[model samples]
Target: MQTSLATSVPSWAVGDVTVHRVDEIPLPPATGPWLLPDATPEVVAGQQWLHPDFADHEGVLRLDSHSFAFVVDGLRVLVDTGIGNGKERANPAWHNLRTDFLERLTAAGFPPESVDLVILTHLHADHVGWNTRNVNGEWVPTFPNSRYLTSRAEREFWAGYDMEEARRQMFRDSVIPVEQAGLLDTIDVPAGGVEIARGLRLIPTPGHTPGHLAVELTSRGGAALITGDCIHHPVQLAHPAVGACVDIDPRQSEATRRELLGSLAGTDTLLLGTHFAPPTAGRVVAHEDAYRLQPVPAA
Candidate 1:
């Protein structure tokens, strides 16, 4: 089946609660050097489903996808907004490109204006790109009524340390405007977790950023954890210690990755990685000594 059509199924038996994967963004190069030498480009390219001429750039570009969430509570809710429309983006490949993200969301029964809550894992450009819409030179919250939630640490870090020119653009373009419009909420990351609504909870997973978080949902005695960028590539499952160069604190990121992987593997948890390939939702399987992703079949 085609990659897009492959993920048409939303609800799946993830332990107890039903889970779904709503792809808000898509990337090309199936294999590149995102992790480290351990996850070689050759190995990633060998995957049958991966595209050959993935990204429009040289040096291992990957055709990957971005994930948001749709929780099956009594009410419909959203997790994160993938890279949105119309921006003077940095990366040549991702810049000024048009995507059908909104359409895809609508196709999956989520209209931009209908989203109940948007839980951003972090304030990164890719994660917050679709938080707002361009309305006559002003950036406004797309989900005007929906509360856009983020962690306090993440908000403070980006607000103070966005020194790089590109970063400033991301904040100025995607984040600050949301706050100005009174749609952003900075939540406390307590040990027990912060309840967004009835069943949805913002669970702190930290490390990738000062306040990186994961969303955990419990209903009908079932649960699933939406891992933001804690685990970027599947190869990380093989070597959880290798940190991404984009990580703020490599050591902390590595530690978190190891702990999260270990903890989740011990349970019947449904693991979801934002930058993982299509059908991004899956479960962990003990492989020899470590663990690997065993993606549930597409519904």
Candidate 2:
């Protein structure tokens, strides 16, 4: 079944950079326990700001597997690649997806060939699935001209990772093919973050994955953050201690969430969540002791 939920492409601008959300699939409503084991319905009920968009009245979390495409300084850079088509995923919903992601990407003004850079936030199945496409029983780089960027630490970790059979398959189909195509470039990210382009940098935001990096865009004094699974849902903002089940280090992920959200709270920085549903981009605002996502009004 098709999972692209947005009827139209949602976009926002920060300084000179224009960001567009290209959704590959809309995941079904997941229970809080499935995502954050500590987040029960009672716990989620207290986060009133999550209603309608991030969560339902029943406390089911709304999420999407999508990518944020940034047009920066005449360059097309994609933050993350959503679950691609024709891949065998352990998650049945993600396997063999034949959605109109490419068509929608073109409609959003980003053809695969036109993309100059593809940034994988981390080496996760969902994030890197679209790195390659299956053609004539051969996996090949989808963006032939683009240079794929990922953290050197992340690439090294996955290189030696004793992954489960399913995830190993993901590495083979989605990640290996890109490397084999000679389009992959692993960068040594600095403590202060590495500037991939003028006004755009990859800030290390680990814990979710040991080497996860969030994309920061600053231009003309305006700023926006492409959160690469740092905080999956708005509910997490209200309870930073709650960590995702998939977090490599739950405690560290919680701490990172608090630090990241605390820093952005009360600031004008726009927050674009990688897994957030429609109206995915928002601002972090201080709410009580924690933070909350204030969804930016549709443009």
Using lDDT as the measure, the top candidate is 2
Q: Which regions of candidate 1 fall more than 4 Å away from where they truly are?
A: 1-18, 34-38, 41-63
Tens digits of per-residue lDDT, candidate 2, 179-290, equal 8889999998877899988888998888898888999999999999988888888888888888888998888788878888988988999999999887888899888987
Worst 10 residues of 1 by lDDT: 48-57
Q: What's the TM-score of every candidate structure?
A: 0.85, 0.95
Model 2 ranges with Cα > 4 A deviation: 1-7
Q: Give the alpha carbon lDDT tens digit for every residue of 49-160 in model 1.
A: 3332222223354435465556555556677777778877777556765777766676666677787778899988778888877889888888887788899988888767
Indicate the residue-level lDDT of 257 in model 2: 84
RMSD in order of candidates: 4.3, 2.4
Window of ten residues with lowest summed lDDT in model 2 = 1-10
Question: TM-score of predicted model 1?
Answer: 0.85
Q: Which model scores highest in TM-score?
A: 2
* Whole-model lDDT values for every prediction: 0.70, 0.86
